[model samples]
Target: MQHIGIAKLGKRTKSLVKRLKAGDIAIIDHVDLDRVTAESLIDAGVEVVINASSFISGRYPNIGPLLMASEGIYLIDAVEEDVFNQIKEGDEIVVRGDKIFHKGKVLASGKTLTVPIIKEKMEEAKKNIGAELEKFATNTLYYMQKEKDLLLEGMKVPESSVNFNGRHTLIVVRGHHYKADLKILRSYIKEVRPILIGVDGGADALLQEGYKPDIIVGDMDSVSDEALNSGAELIVHAYKDGSAPGLERLKKMNLPSKLFNALGTSEDIAMILAYEKGADLIVAVGTHANLVEFLDKGRAGMASTFLVRLKIGEKLVDAKGVSKLYQSRAKISHLIILVFAAFTTTITIIMSSTTIRGILRLIILKIRLYWGF
Candidate 1:
């Protein structure tokens, strides 16, 4: 069958998989069969696949050809661009080796379609191994819960701490989708410009993006010294009694911070702090907004987030997937200005250099001699 040429599979494969619907044959440009990403794609039920990458280009064991063969899927390698040029979006074509046997004729020859078959096999594997996965997930959840309890106990201390007044604040949580969400929010840094706060690892994420978080609030396990020293106010999340274990880490780093003895996630405390600080607008990015994401992180209930968001009410905006909703487009004027600046800089550099002038003159003389210019 004719497949759409949506090749160039790399780090963006996951996003593309989420966007694609079933029965759409994706012509993947490259394949790394041994990677977990390959398995994820296979599980996503991509109907047809083409591997435009070299199977044994290096010492790395190529798994694409083997994966296709084991799954009884057609595959081809070292084919030319002519094969892809012939295929359209909705053409019925039989895939076999490099040659596409279509209607008793060789329509196009190219790499094997491995993604669709791998997806089918991955589904079969998941069904057979579903129970084990569930059990593992359950155990992980239990462990996380116990850890959260321990952390909560350590957070309780009878000390002077920061108080929260009902204001709008966003507390970012570290999770699987955190990076993706953070990238989305980075673009809106100037627009939303909320009191940026990070919870532990989330603070590290902010630091990674060169953003000095306004406040760092969390248990302080995963946050780095660099992040703590990033000029943001630090608030250690503690229990209702105001005991905080994270304080020790800060002490070790010779950093001073206020302890906020409270219940719920560090993000919840951050929101409370924002509200208390009279923040009118609270926009949360890379923060958990859905039950699945929360549960995945072993949170039993998002009571704190619920209450905090409730308090913020009208002023709170959850920008979880805002990056996907809009893309920054370069304006014509901006592009023109950039191009003009680039040309001017190039001319200036060329005019300022004797060696470059000689090289250009030699090239121009060669061109003239060749074309009689």
Candidate 2:
């Protein structure tokens, strides 16, 4: 029931956990009810939440409202700064309609305030994002072509025999909000369990969540050595001319890896490899699937991804933005209880059964005799 100003809420979003740890109630301003922001706030253990800007206030399962209710946190929406100003930090504030009560004291009384129309603001943000995506796609396309040219050259050289069966394989490309996306794709992962592959920085992303990738495929830049040494097979994306700049780095780490002289990004090569290896399903996580996502990478064309998707057809599932739609925080308490129960049951059965007792006694006697004890 504490009253805090809107300014304090703005500051808490930047480092919510730190503020909560210091015993500050948070007021979140201008939240989109996006899953990522909601989960973050919940994880930070905020006691009460106040949303200044929420597009779908009570209609949808917005992250803010869902999290607030799930974590037993109080929620108040559509309040103005005037109401905020009337309340100070640590003041017990209660909300009943538009009235705010602070420790049984009336702070302010008014009808629910309406927010300014923000469709224009949203459109502006989308427009800016689109522009950035286009630039990224262009750059990505250029690099892909360059890499493709090099891969073509390497094909001319005699290389080790590689097996290919057209398997559906997924290569992850970790970008913004990738962690959230991964959480959403957890079910798909358990179901498909595709030959999990990581491309450059994506390998680190997998490692961050304790997922040991089946293969680490990339140009060797932006990936940590720990990821490279995670016991997964390594495939270096090299130019067609058979020169892989990343090979030296792997050698420096005393690691052994295969060179994939291909003309696409590491992700592209990974898909190609998986498809060629006869994978049944390809589930992508934190990878570019839409135009904006591809453009964000500065690629001119998502030719590789497009072709791979087409080739994979119904087997391909893009997991980008999936987290925004779903939320799951797995609790292992039941699993822990099951394990403990199983162990206790086994102990009880062994101790109570005459046959088991005789077997144990014989085994102990044999052990003692063997040791001359």
Candidate 3:
């Protein structure tokens, strides 16, 4: 690209997304960019991404750069560690083949990511992925051996005010395409009124959609203070020995919460909790469902998730990216019916109104008198 506009800077892509407008250049200090971050940048309508860290370190095929490049965004890879420090926010900048400039001076240089390069890197990543998968298997076996109770007998959770018995429970995680998925299930959420459970940052996601979470489950690191106090019942997911760091934060905020010691990720616990509460169905949005996604979340072992599926696969449904399934609008037939109803209501109003009928007759009589008919 010949020229670019103001630079929006943030170390975390998620934090930066709220400020990004269409065509804004994003400068982030992220390494091995995950697909979710790339999707967020794309959704924010950013045209250029300047990374202060490696986009792909050949570490298990991090799909961020590939997704960005494919989406027609210019991605400059790893200019320098000091790129973030050197570039000030709101500075108008120019890009020329991996070089970033301001005031006719080159600020930093790096490699411009291309489709071919991404394919090559992905090939290299495939080789690395094998070893990573092996290690993940080992970790899963180790954790499964230690935490067999979570799957075998089920987890004994603390008493909760929100009941999930015989109800459909929706668990949201601030993961890939969470916003879109939640939007797609809007009708289901409204009609069924599923028990809403927000996992960490997912609580913020629910709040963004104007829905209050019935329960908030997670480590409580990324959720906002407002969400924590939105009257959602809080459950702190602690380690097996019952040490909860997030619990301390809740206490400091004077918020009441229960403790749940589990082995899997918070999202996993959310599912398990709904399952044990006798939920008829569990609909998950933005939760990791595949190996690539689990890797995207930087988790080595999915033992807890594996066991969770084994325990409740019949009742569980993953609705990741469900927004792509349909258009975000009423159907043409539906719109036509709505228009017809409005037209029929107007006609009925006109027919029933004496003033309007008299006005219409008078106007017609006047027209006839004027025409001499």
Residue range 277-371, candidate 2, lDDT tens digits: 66676767776666544433434566566555655577667776777776655669988988999999999999989999999999999999999
Candidate with maximal lDDT = 3
TM-score of each: 0.47, 0.47, 0.78
- Kindly give the stretch of ten consecutive residues in candidate 1 with the minimal lDDT sum: 3-12
Instruction: Report the lDDT tens digits of candidate 1 across residue range 57-175.
Output: 33223344455445543445445445556555455555544565545687656545355544554455445444544554575455545445323333333232333334345557564
Alpha carbon lDDT of each predicted model: 0.59, 0.61, 0.88
Cα displacement (angstroms), candidate 3, residue 37, comes to: 1.7
Candidate 2 regions exceeding 4 Å error are: 1-170, 187-192, 328-373
TM accuracy, model 1: 0.47
Q: What is the C-alpha RMSD of each candidate to the true structure, in Å?
A: 16.9, 12.8, 4.2
Q: What lDDT score goes with residue 85 in model 3?
A: 76
